[model samples]
Target: MTTTQNQDTLERLREDYPGWRIWRSRRGTRPAGWVATSLTPQDGRAPTLHADTAEELELQLKNPPMGIGLDIPGQLEWSGGR
Candidate 1:
């Protein structure tokens, strides 16, 4: 995909899964893979997921590391600082 497409996908993922920072790893002109880091780790369980593509990373996020998926549909927005 193009850089613009990649950026759009990244933004969508961030919106879909709140409290997370997603990005691609530096390899060359192209990225080697994707990486996701939880912004608000709960109970020290949030894990950094690495995947070969955006789809794979998203799939991994569906069943997050140690069952720490934070993407709950209809979940209220928390204003309190973590």
Candidate 2:
């Protein structure tokens, strides 16, 4: 997992979703990857979404699932049609 990219993505999520707690976990040294999660009142024991990489996590933050109940402040500018 790229620490720089993971932290950057985490900060972006925090900025987009106030009051929602976000965190990241490294997928150990073997099959290297990172998992980012967001927890809210609507999400009981599980995260609202999980992403395998920093890039994917950023994408999820930009386009979250409907009815998650978290209020995002504004729209994110997408690039490359992703």
Q: For candidate 1, what is the total of clashing residue pairs? A: 0
Q: Which stretches of candidate 1 lie over 4 Å from their true place?
A: 44-46, 67-82
Query: Residue pairs in steric clash, candidate 1?
Result: none
Error of 2 at 31 (Å): 9.9
TM-score of each: 0.68, 0.43
Least accurate 10 contiguous residues by lDDT in model 1: 65-74
Residue pairs with backbone atoms closer than 3 Å in model 2 (clashes): none
Q: What TM-score does structure 2 among the candidates reach?
A: 0.43
lDDT of 1 by residue, 37-80 (tens): 87766634456888999999999788776635556657856779
Q: Compute the lDDT for candidate 1.
A: 0.81
Q: How do the residues 9-78 of candidate 2 rate in per-residue lDDT, one tens digit apiece?
A: 6787678766456666545644344344545545432355566765675576666656544455575544
